[model samples]
Target: MGCTTSRYATGKKKPVPIREIVVFVPSTRVPKEIDLRRPLRGSLSEGLLERLAALRAKVVALSEKWSLNCSTPTGNIATED
Candidate 1:
């Protein structure tokens, strides 16, 4: 049996469990004075920019999916289990 205190009450009003997720993104610092007009051909900057774009897309998708899953009703989740 569960505790009877109001603080320990079970049901929809109960606090939802939470887990922290951390993602480390590697990056390099560039000087502000770097010439923007310079071409990126055959340089590490080109590859880094491409990888950043891909990571941004993946992060956006994951955020959307997590929001949907967390907002779902607990009853619906329990039934599916």
Candidate 2:
């Protein structure tokens, strides 16, 4: 018998039919990483590059603040009067 055939005659449990499952996952396109050590090469406008740098600085500041808050001992702080 062919491999696809069920093995009912061998007194064994019949093999389950193979099924194809297609899952469609929606995802956002992420930009490729740019090496900050080197200068950017493109026709990108200077204004846009400045804006990006400002945003990066803001992100770094927020990250530092988050780390400081997390490192503090929350249990030792009195929450109520």
Candidate 3:
């Protein structure tokens, strides 16, 4: 899961050095799902559809455990603004 040195891979595929641990989670009340039932003209690519499905599943998993031990953000997120 990591390199030989104290470094972690992030963003791009290349390995890079990281100074500290960061937890990046979206903080917002779950939005209600609405099905507008919009039609599509052609079949979407299989890779795109697979990635979308994975994202949907991840959201569902996160939402289910979202209420358990939720903590208030204690630090400023903007490092340089």
Best candidate according to lDDT: 3
* lDDT for each residue of candidate 3 in 1-81, tens digit (9 for 90 to 100): 333454446656666655455665656455466432233214666576667667766776777567443564466554432
List where candidate 2 sits over 4 angstroms from the true fold: 1-38, 75-81
lDDT of each: 0.49, 0.54, 0.56
User: Tens digits of per-residue lDDT for model 2 on 1-81?
Assistant: 223543353666776443433334333233344544237537556777777877776766666676666555454433333
Candidate 1's residue-wise lDDT over 1-81, tens digit each?
A: 322333423656785433332334333222233332245445647777677557666666666666666555444232322
lDDT of 2: 0.54
Per candidate, the number of residue pairs that clash is: 0, 0, 0
* Candidate that scores best on TM-score: 2
Runs of candidate 3 with Cα error greater than 4 angstroms are 1-41, 70-81
TM-score order, best first, reads: 2, 1, 3
What TM-score, over all chains together, does every model reach? 0.38, 0.43, 0.34
lDDT of 3: 0.56
lDDT pick, better of 1 and 2: 2
RMSD of 1: 12.5
